[model samples]
Target: MSKKGDFEAVRKDIAELMHQPEYDDGSAGPVLVRLAWHSAGTFDAETDTGGSNGAGMRYEAEGGDPANAGLQHARVFLEPVKDKHSWITYADLWTLAGVVAIKEMGGPTIAWKGGRTDYVDDSKLPPRGRLPDGAKGADHLRWIFYRMGFNDQEIVALSGAHNLGRCHSDRSGFEGAWVNNPTQFSNQYFRLLLSLQWRKKTLKSGIEQFVNFDEDSETELMMLPTDIALTQDKSFRKYVELYARDKERFFEDFSRVFAKLVELGIQRDADGNITNTDNEKGGYHA
Candidate 1:
């Protein structure tokens, strides 16, 4: 095991593990990103609960939630890295895995800190249904993200991550990739959202989603109802058009928003020490 506070070493290991031939799209990057997103996405600003401070997903309370289905692949992929670096907490490792995975996958370099604790604060554990629903519309999108303190621009920027991952039918009841190159990270998701004429299609699972056929790739691309809602709402569509037109702007905004997302519910001192984290077990103190 590596020495304590060696996050750089951990980052290298996560990058190496991104290549998984047996996993979806031949990479663990997407799921790793999703794991990190779901981990911190549980934050409720009003209650000062959830967020990445506690690795609650390690238990059934968070892990068994339907919103988190299939993320075990991400945790299992990082297990070897965690074992090799025993000093790193699951909270820090999970979030860092995502930051590394995004950079390794050619996305923007996100700013991340590593003081998160794995100590499960029972009172702070987020309840089920806190995550965004793929089948929902604009109002639901606003309700879900606004609770986490995200604005319309930030909401649209975060959706840009769809460029790297596909929805699994068995897991989310939604299937297909949002972009042609599911492993590469880019503004392709925004480009496709505006360019394609997506039609609502009902799958055998009785789930309805938007689809568009790409003649070049001869493959079908998809958009969640929430994704389509981005264009339907004028407030959200402005950011969509901005991201689609300027790739650099999208990357910049996404980096800031994602960093903000992970840091939710984490109160830090001026020196960057996490004040709200439980310092007893697997926790960091300045």
Candidate 2:
């Protein structure tokens, strides 16, 4: 077990676990990224309800949501790490794993601080349908992200995470990856979004998405309706175009915006300790 408060050891363990040869794309990084995003993305700024603090996904109410399908692989990947370091909260471990995975996958260095608790406050839990729908467009994107206090630029920057993972047909009812090299993080997603002529395709599952076949790679790349919506919207498109052209700028913006994302609804003291946390014992298993 790591010494108390030894987050560095936790970070190292997460790094070691990234080499999942049997997993999707031969790495657990992408799913770990998704797990962290889903864990924190439920935040509602107005209600001050959902965020990464509770680690509520361990329960059926949140975990059973259709939108969170396939994230179990991520949680399971981290379980051994959790067992190794029993002191770390699931909330903190999930978020930190994402930060570490991004860096391990050659992405920007995201700033993250740990103090989240495993305490599940029922009244504070976010209701179902809080996650953005991949089948939706610009208006739906705005409605979902705006509630989480993200602006159009931040929304575009966050969408860049798609460069990592592919959608599973059985899980999300969507198929294919956004970029050829899904494991490495880069501006390729934005670049492909601007450069490719994506044709609408309906899967056998009766799901709709946009696709572009790469002649060189002989592989089909895809974009969710929400991803296509970025280019279609004028405000969102500008950031996408900028990110496509300037990799450094995207890295900087993504680092800041993603840091803000994981920190949503978390109140902190001057010393950076999380203040608004339930310290009482008795919470769901994570």
Candidate 3:
């Protein structure tokens, strides 16, 4: 068999193993996406190329990022899968898990590709300040992602991820998740964003304030200053509105941009191939 055939066979095996109860703890999916985000978020256009394609967080220094506090769990969870399917790199596995989790959770179908290779040493680790602070506003949002080459529309589409996970006080010092149904993926984030009338809340130490969108009916969702700015800014709001109106459009755009995000900061092989077959079996392990 050719190398590609061997790779696909390993992918099928990994996909089958993913259905076993040993792999399902219920927490790994979202955390895996978070891990992918943290890994890729470290990229800086000026100097570092430490995005999801390298699995750079295995190094002590890279894993120490304040935003990546809980990511060790994801790395540990994938060890068995990595060991069994040694053909795929950790960087590719982690990001592919994110894509699987999003689709499994009833969200968009993320078109995935994979060409990541493992790093031989810690010297290649990226510098910090790549992930967005939950306490930041529009300017901070722009500066962080723009340096990575993302435009305003891409930023807004990416924020849809807020729909999947909650802000951990221990992890990010931000309280509550973005949506009530944090585990399930949907367009509820945008719906709540547009319908809710937000009021500012005072905070003790953070640079940003919490927003109360609709406290009484439990329809109120808190937004970080950066998340709120999406609606406040005219250009960003245009993208938001488009996403709200058309789920297909949002899914299509997100698939392209998120794939691009995961692809940054890594060297691809001459083949330029990105494999998406890490796990093809449907649903969680348990």
Show the lowest summed lDDT stretch of 10 residues, model 2. Answer: 277-286
Give all TM-scores, in the order shown: 0.98, 0.98, 0.81
Which candidate would rank higher by lDDT, 1 or 3? 1
lDDT (C-alpha) at residue 18 in model 3:
37
Clashes of each: 0, 0, 3
lDDT of 3 at 88: 67
* RMSD in Å for all candidates: 0.8, 2.1, 6.4
Model 2 Cα displacement at 231 (Å)? 0.6
Residue-wise C-alpha lDDT for candidate 3, range 106-219, written one tens digit per residue = 777776666565643345457777788766678888999998889999999898887776666666666666677776777777877787776676556453545665556565
Model 2, residue 84: displacement in angstroms?
0.4
**Top candidate when judged by TM-score against the true structure:** 1
TM-score for predicted model 3 compared with the true structure: 0.81
Please report how far candidate 3 places residue 142 from its true position, in Å. 1.0
> Rank by TM-score, descending?
1, 2, 3
Stronger candidate by TM-score (1 vs 2):
1
Cα lDDT of model 3 overall?
0.69
Predict model 2's lDDT versus the native.
0.93
lDDT of 2 by residue, 193-248 (tens): 99999999999888999999999999999999999999999999999999999999
